[model samples]
Target: MSAAPVIVIGSGLAGLMTALTLAPMPVVLVTAGRLGQAGSSPLAQGGVAAAIGVDDDTSLHLADTLAAGDGLCDAASAREIVGRGRDAIMALESHGVRFDRKPDGSYALGLEAAHSRHRIVHVDGDATGAGIVKALVAKVRETASITILEDCRALRLIKRDDRVVGVCLEGKGPVAARAVVLATGGAGGLYEATTTPLGNLGQGAALAGRVGARLADMEFVQFHPTALAVSAPRLPLISEAVRGEGAILINDRGERFMADQPGQELAPRDVVARAIAAEIDAGRKVYLDARAALGEGFVRRFPGIFALCQEHGIDPARMPIPVRPATHYHMGGIAADCDGRTNVPGLWAVGEAACTGLHGANRLASNSLLEAAVMGLNAGRAIASEMTAATVRLEPVSLPQMSDPAPVRAIVSRGLGILRHETGLRAAICALLPKAGHDDAAAVALAMAVAAFARCESRGSHARTDYPHKNASGTRKLFTMDEAFAFARELAASQPLSRTA
Candidate 1:
């Protein structure tokens, strides 16, 4: 907002990349916390997914990407990213990201769930995200054209009919621009246990929907299979790459129960997470047995996780880790092209914020970090081409007044979180309708409902018990706020009233 020509919402990998790639363009990067603090970029342990290896062709990578997407991916989008992945990685290297290399000096690659080959280019052995973000942050700091603003939160998009002229801020004043890019991360905060930062509450997606940006796959939120559950509220996440490195999932009896998927110890996150959930549901505690797998390098490779586990009296060097399926990534978002351009003009979305269709129903292991870096660059470059001479307007719009959302949050957290059913969803809708105040949170709730109602099939991460069909629903689904509400109404009207109530 603060009188900048271009404004970015969050300061994660996506926001920083957007600012950096469009160099010499007047850009303002806003963050709810410090630049590297908010969003999941820093916490990412796995590396970027790219076709950097000799044997791994772009076509092969594309095939893996689409296969993981589960028949809902845009073929053109998948092809575009795979083709341009090497260039994006090279850009990261130019920005000072030091990737791990093999003995002969080639880049080290690792395998993850559902990938046909090992192509995850890590920075640190385990903390790949932290290292890459650190480099990018340093690069952004020295850029004269980029203005990084800390402690500012974005409220919503300022729309003049269809185009987004600017965005409203929570504390700071509005900064008008010809174009706005929403790099503001995902909706993990909507859940009880999340690996993402507290700021990631689906604000970007909500902002897009409020402005009528065509959103897809909102129901397909990718839940991390190995987030550690403890006495805390938002559980700390254990990286999937740990499992990629041979960490085994074991029940209380120390029996490995994830043989259903190939590479028993390391399967796709959804499969492993469901396996862990089923293990817990069957009256047994589940743990990630990293002691035998990681051995001595466990602490060195993943110091953050090692320290966290040690804090809870469970050393990864000697014992297994407590894990559960927690909200991780939203596969659905403001639908955008490869260049991060959305349906609406003067607006773009990148990183986890944009549904680029790269991640279809389920995101393969490290593809998230890969998509953020790749798409972030594409969005920034695209934004730089227009509107240098346009009139800049920075009008102050009043922030939306917020009421207590505890009741609504409770209802959503209980009824809408994790596994869902039609009966519980209807009850949740009835309970929240009265309390759906004029707030950003309610707008986000509406966005969730838009895709939730459209897809009756329980495909990918969004599980619907009442309609438990797993096959594809043939046509792509989309819904507006009115339509989502109408579905709720239709469901409510059909159910008979309770006799004793």
Candidate 2:
């Protein structure tokens, strides 16, 4: 028997990288929307983090990553992934990602929060994601072995005994494959205010969890502190690169509020997000004042963001941009090892969909791109190597009936957003679990809430209002779908339910 073609779900940096990496071998890349239109990857303004600077090294990158993770980052995986940053950048460059370079013929490395060195490799100033994805999409187009399924959403994984045989798409029915790679981005779309693309509703996590794939770190959702406070559906991210270049956060009173914190504006994302949340809770509007700092150069440096500001009629060259904390990244997903292999055979997870312990509690700025590239490459190779002669069966698996996203988004925003409490989290679990039923997004949401409920003390992005401090124990909670539902029902049964929830 010959090996079957691999089916890869999602079309972000991870999915593209994985498919491209598995070159020469046949691959079917599926996305919910047209190529390059949606997914959180193209919207990533911050460039890929890598230690390519002459003064930088992988050890320093590892230290910064570990610190940002808040003690839950898998140390071995962190070191391994961070160590390959330079190689990952080079690989991306080969695939048409033209990173910005200085006039002196060196990589124009940009600085980001919590990074010890100026090691962010960007393109077109602030439109790094757009540049990289455009190039990779072009490369994928040129490749004859890769078949792209545009406007097709993956519904569920077709299982035969233990190993995943293929994926069932929405418009297109079930497609058989020897291996499956889930690169479905994060679950940020589960929240009301988020920086992610609208379609990124944790579909990947939900699909994987439906088939008993282990999920880890479901509680840590990184909130970016500087999403443009607009009334629009999708929130525009004011890249951390702006803050890296001396932009200061201000309140309605023209006060430089970050002055009290140790690192001020340069603190880890969790710290900055919490600070912004605190300011908002205190009845003060927050703003990112780039007027004095970047001045005229703001447009030239961050043309994408500047254009965004202009699109909304707020000139960054003059006034400060109104900003607030928005759901950005989920540091949890289908638990996969370094090679992107899930607990179930023939099923692999890469990019944001896979919790490889790279991001831990909170992901450092730009590390998401780096992880996506490195892990996608590794997973591609791993899957390619696993294409053996063993015959796999593709059974007709029933797809999950998902509910309206509005209610699920509302539940996540109220129960699992910036601040969480025991009562509210339990209430949220009860509401979300029943609504979720067998839906992947709801399943992932319930998992996140259950993980949040399990962790009593605040740590990293999983902050709890009741247990207001970090606990002595540093633990990463892993859960199966059954385990999560059982725990949620048990927990909800023990507590009195809230009428509003």
RMSD of each: 2.6, 1.3
**Which 10-residue window in model 1 sums to the lowest lDDT?**
492-501
Worst 10 residues of 2 by lDDT: 387-396
Query: lDDT scores for all predictions?
Result: 0.77, 0.89
lDDT (10s digit) by residue, model 2, range 1-501: 776788888888999999999998988999889997779999989899999899999999999999999889999999989899988998998998888999999999999999999999999999999999999999999999999999888888888877788788887677778788999899988888998987788887888888899999999999999999999788999999999999999999999989989889999998999999999999999999998889999999999999999999999989999999999998999999988999998889998899989888999889999999999899998887763635565556687775678888888898888899987898789888777676667778898999998999989998899998988877888889889999988877877586754
In terms of TM-score, the best-performing candidate is 2
lDDT of 1 at 226: 85
Clash count for candidate 2 is 0
Q: What is the lDDT of residue 79 in candidate 1?
A: 88
Error of 1 at 43 (Å): 1.1
Q: Write model 1 residue lDDT over 1-501, tens digit each, in one string.
A: 243478887777888888898888888788888878777888888788888898798888898887777777888988888788788889899999999998999989887778778888987677888998999999999999988888877776787667788888777667676578888888877666677775577778777777778877777878788888787766787877787778888888988788666767666666667777788888899888888778888987778788888888888888888888888888888888888898888889998988888888888778877788888888888887775535456567656665554555666666665577766666666555544436666556655753665567776667787777776454446555455556656655776325321
Model 1, position 241, has a per-residue lDDT of 73
